[model samples]
Target: MFISISIPLADETRVRPYTIASSPEDGDLFEIVFNRVPGGAGVAWLFERKAGDEINFTGPFGAFTLERAPERELVFIAEGTAIAPIRPMLRRVFEQKPGHPVRLLYAADRVEHLLFRGEIEGHAIAHPQFQFETIIADGGQEALYARIMAEVERRWVVTDNDRMRHFYVCGIGAGVLRIRDLLRGAGYERRAVRYEQW
Candidate 1:
């Protein structure tokens, strides 16, 4: 789910949607992850907030969530800050559906841009059912998608009866669309792939 925070600028109020990175099990405390975009008012406003400052938001919005398909293997593809939502989903899967096999293919422009890297790696080490891979796409989104597609082709064998796999992809609009289309072209059904694009 996401929260819409309104930032009051000198001219107008700008609303930005941020996915909650913390798990529901975390109780009263929650977290969000974002990178500061140059000249972006929403992130600028958020970055300027100090302790004791109060910010108003409305949410628990968006239907982009994990499907109740414990029998299916889960594959998550996330780029950049899109990993925010996937973090909680990973927690849910590991906690509630430990038997389900999961693979996370995460990409970032640089190694430093890979969020939660150590934590995700730890998950891989701890859970045999979980696998993680990271791609450094210095050549931008196209490079990221290309590397992801190559990995998918090499690692997964899509077949007519491959109904036991579910894909969750999140990224910028173009990259998300490209990956979704690639999956579809590889003979996966529309319902088998769930995506959130911004």
Candidate 2:
């Protein structure tokens, strides 16, 4: 499901490829979530978008997708806006197998900064097989206050069967590095983990 979009050049330079967040059944509109960085062209342009605005993009271009494999558990680890893709992937996963053991660990600076928190909770509450955990890096609350590394390690390697579950981590540069290191330490079998770091 690929479409071309005409995103305005926020930095007067380039229009980056952003995974449209909307599900294919949702129709013609493509939803994307991004933050404005200091010099990020895509984010800058995306920030100025209004309803009815036009943007250009190419693809459906990720090798990563939610394929039904009920025998295997799955884990999604996202930081900040990276949850956009995870959201859709979860939708696909649940649609195919409502009771599959899928864990979502979303890390953010604060609860307010957590994207799709309500939606995550709703899914967890509605489905017994879906589990959701949030780690706040700001330490402003009693909830998991560890960095992503510490928080993520809790579930990286499922010891029950010694079978490394599928792991996906998405975030910025340093955050991605930390996740990779954490997974490596957790004995995740390397190949079972997929990552997308901005």
Candidate 3:
């Protein structure tokens, strides 16, 4: 899910979208994660806001959520801040469908870029059915995509139930496209692999 925040600038309004980071189970409060981009007007306005300041926005938008395939294995692939939506999906799965097998294959240029690492690790420790893997590719997006493809090939492409798995991918356009194509080429149905490009 995401929210489009309207920021009022000197002459006009600028809108920016951010993924909702908190779980719906967290009553009354929602969280958004973002990196402070230099010279970004929307982020700059957001950063200057004080407590109790009113902000205009609209949301809970986007179809990036957990599928209703309770029997299918869940494979979530996220990179950098793209993990925002995946975090809540994982929480929902553990809360409502704990028996389903879930795997998270996350990548970033650096370890510090991996969001919610601790929480995800906690879930892995608590749920035997949950698996988490991290890939740090300092060489850039191309290297990241290569490593992710390698991991996917190792974990799912060779499995007998390869087509029975549900994949959720979110990341840069090139990376997301590469993974989606790999899955599709491996004979998985298009619907079985959902993706969002950042």
Candidate 4:
């Protein structure tokens, strides 16, 4: 689908790539969720959009295209609205490899603020191999207590096939880097990790 997006400014013009947050079959109009950050370029405008406002964008770009292959396991790590790319990937993966092992770990400031929780949960129920863990930064749950970098290391066991599993991570600059380092340290082959930086 093609869209023409207009924000509060002109210089930001360009059809930025964005995964349709809503299900693709849901139709032409879709939502792209984002947090308002201090001096944030794209997000600042995105968060302020009113209902029915026209925004220009062409997608689903990058190497993160949503497609499925039964041979590979999937690991999705997302922070805030970075889930954009991961969400569509999951939908496509499930459609093709219904029983493939897929895990999604999303970090958020609070449980109430988690994005697409219901969708992820439903996916997990339908596909046993699909599991989701929500890490609330301020929550007391053990899974939510540690930083994302440490958590990835603690969970994944490095093996000869570590290079085979697909890893998708997106978020703030620092968090993305830290997770990359952790993955490398955990014996994940450098070539195995795919990252999208915001």
Candidate number of the best TM-score: 1
TM-score of 1: 0.90
Q: Per-residue alpha-carbon lDDT of model 1 for 1-198, expressed as tens digits?
A: 999998888898998899999888899878998778768887998999998899889997998887353577899999889999898888778877566789999988899998999999988988898989888878966888788777776666443446557899988758788788877777777888889997
Error of 2 at 182 (Å): 3.1
Model 3 misplaced stretches (Cα beyond 4 Å): 10-12, 38-41, 67-69, 158-161
- Return the top candidate by lDDT: 3
What TM-score does candidate 4 get on C-alpha atoms?
A: 0.77
Task: Write down the lDDT of every candidate, Cα atoms only.
Answer: 0.84, 0.69, 0.87, 0.69
Where model 4 places Cα greater than 4 Å from the true spot, the runs are 1-6, 10-19, 56-60, 139-146, 157-163
CA deviation > 4 Å runs, candidate 2? 1-12, 39-41, 98-100, 139-146, 157-161
- Stretches off by above 4 angstroms in model 1 are 67-69, 157-163
| Residue-level lDDT tens digits of model 4 in 1-198 | 113344546675533444456667668657666566677676666766787776655444446455555467878898767787677778878878654578898988777667888988999898899889877786532334257766677677542445557688887666687777777766677767878776
TM-score per candidate: 0.90, 0.80, 0.89, 0.77
